[model samples]
Each structure stands twice: as C-alpha cells, then as structure tokens.
Target: MKTNHPGPLVGILSARKADGSIAGNGPLFIALQKKLISLDGKSFVFIPEDAGIDHIMGYTFLPEQNHWKKEKFRYPDIVYNRVPFRKSEQSEQCQQFFTILNEKNIPYFNPCFIDKFELYELFKRHSFLKTFLPETILIEGKKDLFLFQKEHKSIYLKPTQSSKGKGILRLRLTDAAELQLDGIHQHELFKSFDHFWEKYGVELLTKNYLAQVEIKSAKYKGNRFDFRILAHGEDKGYTVTGVGIRQSQTQDITTHIPSGGRLLPYEILQTNEHDNFIEAIVPEIGMALSDRYGYFGEFSIDAGVSMTGHHYIYEVNSKPMRFDEEEIEEKKMEQLCRIFLQLSDYEN
Candidate 1:
C-alpha cells in the first residue's frame, strides 16, 4: 500500500496484549524503532488485531521524547515480524496478513515457519554440506529410536518445531547397558531398552521428532557451548553481521541463552580459520534456503565445534532472538536498516 510518510514506513509486527501494546521483547522492538529513525527511516509496531486490508493502527517510538506515539498508518512498505511464539504467528489474522502481503508484493523477513525435519532434508541434498551436519533421521516411531540407539552411545530426540530446549529427550546408553532418558525436567534410568520403550510407549510415537547423533561438543567451564552466527541478506548478498557463543547453563540438551545459558565471545570457540570457513558457508546456506523457499532477510545458524576441532551445524533459526551483547545488537540494527532500505529501493 502507498503511504504519505516522508521516509519509507517499516512495520514491526508482533503479538500484543488486550490494550494493543506489544507484549514480548519490548527492548528489541524499541531498539529497532530507534535504529530505523537513526538511518532517517521511520517504523511502527503493529499487531494482528490492528491490521486491516487498507491500514493499520500502530505505535511509533519517539527516541527524542523517550515515549511511544500512536498513529494510523498505511500498510508499511516492509514488515519485520518478531512474533515470538509459533502459535500466535499461525493465528488466523497473522496467516491472512501473510497472504495479503504476498498479494500486495510487500516484502517481509523470514516469510514462513520452517520445520527442523524439512531443513534436515534440505541440508542432506547438498553433498558439500554433509560434513557440517550431524547424522540425523526423522523418527517415525519406536523403530527409529531402536535403530538409532544401536549405533550411537547418545542421541537426541528433538521436536521438529520446538524452542528453548523444551521437550527434548536425550537418550544415553551407559557401559552397564542401562538406558537413561534425560530431559529439561525429567530424568529416568531403565535397566533395559524394552523397559524404557514400555514406559514411554505410544506417547513417543504421537509426536514428530528428529533422532540425531549427539556431538561431543567443545566445552567451556564444564558446560557444552556452541556458536550462533547471525547473518543478514542485502542487495549484494548475505553477510555475517555478528557471532556469539552460548554456553548451556545446565546439563540440558541445548545452549539457547534463554534457557539459563550465558553469552560468550565468538572468539572463545573459533579460530581465524574456523571463522573464515563459517563466513564462507553462511551465504551459501542462506542462498540454498532462498533458492528452495524464496527470500529471507536474516537467519541465526547454530554450529557446534567438537573437541577435535570439527565443526557441524546444529540448527537454523528463521526468526532468531536478540543477542545480549551491545555490539551485536547494534550490528543487528544496521542489518535491519539494510534490509529495509534495499527492499524499499527495489520497490520504488
């Protein structure tokens, strides 16, 4: 939709409370708004409830005055979606907005939710990327678990669409041949594999999971850690804007910072060679995904380094959470501006 705003109007779409205020990640929304203004661009926050075919009522942050100003705005030129939860993003209004934006040709970042199982299949098709991926298989039922257990001492059964290390089951076979199931909250030990199967039973078969051989990752302060490479797309190509290390806070499966994890410098895990290798591959992965599923403005790729220095990709986040570092945060803002300006330039 056309707008009379002096600068290109960008919209930060998010989930809101009953009062029409953005509910989650308030700092991120505010940082993005101020950053856009710094680049002589304007943006506002809009929720699904405020969105309509022709216009949307949104809230703009005035950094100078340090407050939000409400206004009725035309459909923005570009929408930076940060709706945290998948269910909220999949709501009827959000789904309808996606269709409307596509019909109007309004560009958006991370246009859709991508499943982990599908992503694994995509990565498997590329021979060159095989070394960077751990052995992974889609778990259909009990059979898949039994087969995976036969080969690996430890394996992780993760939901296809899960976050924050939630609902992940880590199965380990000890020297005594005992089966142990470890999760965020629950931990159980069984004398036999059959006994473990009988305990979990049909509950395991109902959910979609990926059976992946657990990597012996590099550890810092006794906790396993991984690197998060934040990459953003520009007119030229995809660029690695920032990198950081996430160390697991507990003995859990994932090192997601939100799950009691701590942020570390990217240098702690990577050498110059490792950085170069990752930087070279980041754009390739971005392009490969884009070729398969259209354009994406950004992605957070989680990669793990083994004790022997071998690196492997663990996950690809379409909509990533904000990093705690100020430098990384600033870089993210810069990338956001690049995405908005580049798309706006093309459309005009």
Candidate 2:
C-alpha cells in the first residue's frame, strides 16, 4: 500500500496474546489496518504495558507476509482504546500509559468502560433522554429487589460491568404469588420472597447489580427483537453508521446474539417511522454522552421498540464488539477510519 499523501499514525490500545500478537478480534483489526493503509495512513496495535514515553513496541500487519510484525513506533498522533477486558483496562500499567499520552498531548477517545449504573444516573440527569431509559436502581439488598418487583411486577437484574448478555436474570411475579426466575441457564420458582432471597437475591448484594424494569419488546414471528445502532462522532456531532436487527430465538430475556439470538435482514423491520425515530434520538444520545463522559469516537446502542410502540434504550457499549452483518461491519470500518483521520488532523 503506497500513497503520495499518507494519513496520520493511529495507535490501537489493546491486550496482547500469549504469543505477543494483539488480542481481540484479529479480523477487525486487520481490516482496519488495511483501510488506513489505503488512505496512505499508518496504524499499529500495542498493549498498555509495552507503551513508552518516546517509543512503543507495537504490531503492524504485513500484507506481504500475511501476518503481524512486531516493531517500535513513535507515540501515535491519536489513540483508540480497544482493551479487550475491564480488568486489564484498570491495571496500573494501563493507567500509566494514559498518563504518558496525556503528558505528550496525544489525543485518545473512549478512555475506559462505562458502568451501567453510572450510565443510568447520567441519563436520568438528561430530561429528554431520561424518558427513554427504563427505571433502574442499584441493588443493595433484598428490600430494593422486593420494592422494584412490587412496582414493575417483572424486572431484570443485570451485572453493571458485564456484556454479551452475561449475568442477567429475569424475575417475574406470577399470579399465584410465586416468584419466577429465569437465567441464561437456569429457571426456577420460589414460593416466597424469603425463599428467593435466600437462594439468589442474597448474593446480588455482594456484587454490583442493577434492577431495571423489563420492556415488553415488539416481536417478529413470536420472537422478541431489537436494534443495534452504531454511531460515530464527526465535526458537527454524531452520525449513525449502521443499524442491525437481532431477534431472540426462543423469546429469551435478551436479544443478544450470544444469548441465543439471531441476526435478521436489515430490511425486515425498516420503516419510515423507525427511521424517523432513530434520526431524532441518535444525535441527542451521542451529545449527552460526550458532555458527561468526554469525547467518544464511537459507541453502539442496544435499543428496542415496545409492544406499545414506544422506543426504549437498553444499553450503550463504549467498546463495541464486531457486528455480524456484512454491511454494518463495512460501514463501521469506514466511519472509524474517518474519525481517526479527523481526530489526528490528517489531510487526506
């Protein structure tokens, strides 16, 4: 890849595998590197522990060799945080690396993961956006869970720091006055609140969990469905990159693919009303997040339309995973490259 006018040097901060290759989605990174190269730009993947003040040990894809090659590079003009896990991002080494980037005045977006409880609180402060959020409360004791259940009848308990529909449980009050609990792997019923708390709710007090009202999402052919909207920041504000639909296979508690959900054709749910609704909300959500959490290059929103025809925002991921849809993935790569160039002030 050769060009007379090359773009800026961008560094992707991520984890390293045992073999020292960059960890996470290799295909996504390879594709991104190729896209940057097409624009005559240079990019590399580096771990926080390997980053230095002057030069960092990093890996760049060698198309000729068809593999990643390790090398040393100067601090990038801009950095994109893609650290694979929450624990790794919280390490001392990662903190120190960011300090170095700050000292050198290098720009970076999405510094860390966003906590679900904190995000809910942030949305509550925004009057317009708050209405779209489900009523959420941090679970501290059995009393909190009981009160929430009594109010909503059915609620979802979610780990604040988890993703891919992990550690989420749905609890509903049956007409028989029993508690019905449904998890990804387990389903059971309790005769009384005490029984439920003794078995499950007691453990939630020890961890960070949020109790949220469950949205009765609209369904397609008896399967609950939702939309994943990818957005990227631009000079003016944020723009929607692409939208993909995920439908639950067995009408499960979540529409996440890992939790037995399947991706459907984008055209299946496309409509003028849906398009207009998304257009009205994406900019507001993006700007609100930026104001509260600093600039974010890109983020993905998990949202659904209720059976009552109202839209609800379920989750926002700062570090988004790879979209399965080909068109969505392609658009994401292109938009991300554009954001990198704009942030680095690269003249393409």
Candidate 3:
C-alpha cells in the first residue's frame, strides 16, 4: 500500500570535488532537485566520498534564500545515480557506499553502469531483442579483427565501457584491401591489413572493445542520423519521455550530441513509418531491459533506422543525457520522481 506521507525522499548520487562541492552536471542536479519538489518529492545531492555508515553529507539548494545549504540526511528512499565517470563510480568509497545501501535494503534505480559489450550479449540472448541488434563481436585479438574485416568491409570498434563517443573508430576496407581508420579528430590509412594491425593491433588487443558490423544508418543532408529516445519505468511499465534525432556534424562513428552532433526534431528526420517503428520498439526495449536488470528508472536508447526502413538499436544508456531546454529536463526529472514515488508506494 501507498504510504501516508507528503513525499518520498530521493537522493541524487554523484562524486564530489575536493572542496566538497558536487561534481558532474551541477546545473542539471539543481534543476532536478527543484523539479522533484514540485512533484511533491524531496531531493538532496549525496556525495559518496562524504557518506558514512550512519548518514551522508547531503547538499540542498534553497531557491527562496538564493543560497545553498548542507544537511545530514540519514538516507533516501531511492538513489538516482548520476555519477559521470566510470573511474569515480568504481572508486573505493563509491563501492562501499553502494554496498552499505544494499545491506540496509535501500533501493536504487538504474543500479549500475551498463557496459556496451555486456548489454549486447544480454540482448543477444533473447531472440526478440537479437533482431534489433547489429552483428557485434568481442575483439579479443587480431584474429577476431581479421575475421570481422573479411566479412564486413566496414566496421566500428568501440570501447566496451565508454560514453560520449570517446575512443570510437570507424574502419573500412577498399576493393584493393587497403584499410582506413577514421577518428573523431583525424583519419589514417594503411597499405594493407598486416600493416594496419602491426602498428595499432597491440594497443587495441590490450583494451576491451567491441567490433560491430556498421549499420547503413539513415542520413540527413549526407550526414548520418539516429534517434535518442529516453524512457522511464514504473511497476506497471515504461514510458518514452522524449524522442529526438542526433545528426553528426562530421562523418564520425557515433552520433552522440556532445561529440559535435546536433539535435533535430523527430518529424524533420523521420517518416511516419520510422516514427511508428521507433514508438513501438522504444517501450519494448525499455521493458525488456528493466525486467533483465531487475529495477531501472530510465534508459536512453540510441536506435538507427536504415534508409530501407530496418530499425537497429545501437545502445541503451542507463545514465542518459538530458536535453538542453529547461522544460524538457524538468519533465524528465518529474518522470523520475514519479517513478521513485511509485516504487516507494509499492515497497511500503
């Protein structure tokens, strides 16, 4: 049954700077806190470094007084993780903090960071989801790369655990077997496969990466484009909060907006058929992932629509990016708060 309370207390978790100020998207946190209150929920920023077994040093913003304040919040009903970097998320303090929460039986949404290769394998296990995923393989060594290149003339090498299009590479083979690599800032050419691997093979083999067959992604004005759809989940199901198209400014391997890409309205970049397909699949992927991951609040799925109308889900981000507009961001925050309250109600 639902609790007879004014609101549920939601905690926004993130790393803090040495000075004890919140790091990673401070403005977004502030906006979310304000929006949470408006939705009849309370929020505070929980810095993992300052958290103890008893309580955490929570930061609260006071819009009326035009200043910030700190308080000792014993704990929140739910935790919304916004920890930006994987390094920080894997830190000793952060791990311990989460362990403490788990021990206390406190629930968290979007529990942990999802790895690219791990997510791909999870989807591959289910036939329904496998249809939407591209042919992806783990890049263990040069042999795997050779097999992939022989089958697909063009491929993408992406870091298994990365975001914002960092360390992504696009490689293509010419009719003469010449290899070319296109990076975010520059491009390089190799005389042959042997030469290409000899120079960069060791570096790649040492790191975790995924080699995927390149999708014939839909394009606008010669630039590749894809949909970035955000979905929020509840006990009943999931809802698509927002849908927008991201077009690459350059011919890069990824279309992440922060990687020099621009956002466009869905209608401008998609046809009615494409829009309908996305609308149907967005919730399917959301619910499927939520069921698999156990409990998740929101997911930002990057899906590509081929010119021929075949839809492919590029990836699912647990911690998705927020839109620039205040209204849209606020709406997302509201959805998050509502989901927390729904879950709290059920648990209570």
Candidate 4:
C-alpha cells in the first residue's frame, strides 16, 4: 500500500510513554494511522523532546510488521496537537516544540487546552449563543460561591483546567436549609453555606474554579443523559461527524464515561427534537470557536436538553476522546483523515 502524497506527513504531537510508545489512547492512534494509510496519506506520533532542527525522532506504523517503527523523518507538513494531559502540554519542552513549528511555518490546529472559564466567556460574547449558556461565574472566593449558589440554588463547581469530570462539586440548597454537596466519591450534608465553605473553601479558592447553574438535564429511565457531538472542519467550515449519548449510571455530577457514565443507543435521541437542536448549534459553535480560538480542525460538544426542554451547552473540548459507538467512531476517523489531507493540501 503506497501513498502518492507521502511527502505530506501528518505529525501527532503527544506525550511519550515510559516504554517509549506514544501516550494517550493507544487504539485511537492505531486506528488513525490505518485511516491515514487508507487515504493515501501518512502520519506519525512524536513527543516534544523528539523534535530537532531539521528532523524529528518519531514512530510510524508498519502494517506488515504490526508495530510502530522508530525513525528520523523530515518535519511534517502539519502537526496535530494531541498532547493528552494539560500538564504535559504546558511543559517547557512542549512550548519550545510549538515555537519550532511556528518558526518553520508548519500548520497545526487545536493549539492548546482551553480553560473552561475562558471558553464560557468566549461563548457569552456571541448574542445568539449567549442564551444557550448556563449562568456561569469564576469562583474566586467564598463570596462568589455563596452568591452563585444563592442565585441558582443548584450549582456546579468545576475546575477550570480539568476534564473528564475531574474535580467537580455539585452544591444544592434544599428547602430544609441544608447545603448538600455531591462529588465523585462522597455526598455530604452541610448545615449552612458557611459550613460548607469552611470545609471546601481553601481547596476551591486556591485553584481556578467556575460555578455554573445546573440545567436539570432531561433524563431517560431515571438516568440523566447528554449528547456528545463531534465535528470536523470541511471547506473552511465545520460539519457534524457523529453524535453519541452518555447516560449517568449513578446519577453522578457528570455524564463523562470515566465518571461512571454508560453509553446509550443514539436511536434514543434520533426520535427527539434534541437531535435537531444539536444539528443546528454544532456548526455555529465550531465557527465561533475557530473565529475566537483560531483554526480548530476538530472539537466535541458536551450539551444537554434541560428538563424544561431548552438546549444548553455545557462544555466544548478541544481534544475529543474516542467514541465508543462504532458508527460514530468510523465517521470520526474518516473526517479526521479528510481534515488532515485538506489542511496539508495533500495531492493524491
């Protein structure tokens, strides 16, 4: 299987494992490599430290060998920032690698991890999108938290820099005058707001957090569900690749699969009006994000239909995780390959 556009190599910037393989989702990388090969393009995964003046020490997949081959290659036509963790992406070496990409004029999309608070602010600026956003405030102190909780009664405190539902706290003010706190592990009842803040304030205040009003998401069979819509750039705009549903297993604070959420059939949403809502807003979101954040080849939206039947946008992830659904995953791979070839202008 030979590719005519072999020169337009795509580089996936990621962390290296202890054993020297590319970190992040292993199956996703392998699938991406195979997809690019089928498209008559090429891709490799490299760490920041592997980059050099004129070449990069990276790993390319060999179909016959059934292994990733370590080799030196010329700078790729474009780089895809897939650095899995925020800590790794923010490292000095990663910063230096991005500088080299800029200096050499190589293109890339999804530059870095977007702060949750900053993304909310960006979306708030657009009048049409503003209505869909939950009332959000940057939690700076007990005062901010208290006021937000008072206004919404039920609010979610989330770390601005974290993902996969990590570091999330849900606070609800019950009619009994008790403040209830729900997290990944424990649920506690605080006698008052001050009491809750006294215990959790230091941790929340010291780190960046955002307080958002809970949407009371519509549920199915007693489990709250949300839509994960993946979109990719095409013809100077973005189009929907697929939509997936994640339902809460324990009615946890988030619908993230890692946080005790389970996948549901997409058919559940296909019969509802929410499907139309997702289709309408996804392209708008992609355009707004790209306009403000620069070229975004791909992104995924975490959205829900409120109990009142209104659509609300919760979060937009720059680096989307692999979809468990086979159809969505296939569409994602096809779109990824097309986006890579289009961005690199690979002639095949």
Indicate which candidate wins on lDDT.
Answer: 2
- Native-referenced Cα lDDT, model 4: 0.86
Per-residue alpha-carbon lDDT of candidate 4 for residues 1-348, written as tens digits (9 for 90 to 100): 224546458898899666865687767778888888876667888899988889999988887789888899888888988999889889999999888888987889988888999989988998878888999999888887898899889999999998889899899999898999999898999999989989988888778888999888888889899998899888877888888899999765888888889998877667558767877777888888888877888999998888888889899999998889999888888887777777777744
Candidate 4, residue 330: the lDDT equals: 89
CA lDDT of each prediction against the hidden true structure? 0.82, 0.87, 0.79, 0.86
Instruction: Please say which candidate is ahead in lDDT: 1 or 3.
Output: 1
- For 57-113, candidate 2 gives per-residue lDDT tens digits of 999997778988889998888899999888888989998888888888788988788
**Candidate 4 collision pairs:** none
**Poorly placed runs, candidate 3 (over 4 Å):** 1-5, 17-21, 325-327, 346-348
C-alpha lDDT of candidate 2 relative to the true structure: 0.87
Better of 1 and 2 by lDDT: 2
Candidate that would win on TM-score: 2
Cα error, residue 135 of model 1, in Å, equals 1.0
Query: What would you estimate as the lDDT of candidate 3?
Result: 0.79
lDDT score, candidate 4, position 13: 88
lDDT of 1: 0.82
* Model 3: per-residue Cα lDDT over 138-249, one tens digit each: 8898888888988999999888988778889988997776898988886999998899889888767777888999998778889989888878875667777878888888
Position 177, candidate 4: lDDT: 89
In angstroms, the error of model 3 at 75 is 1.2
Cα error of candidate 1 at position 119, Å: 0.7
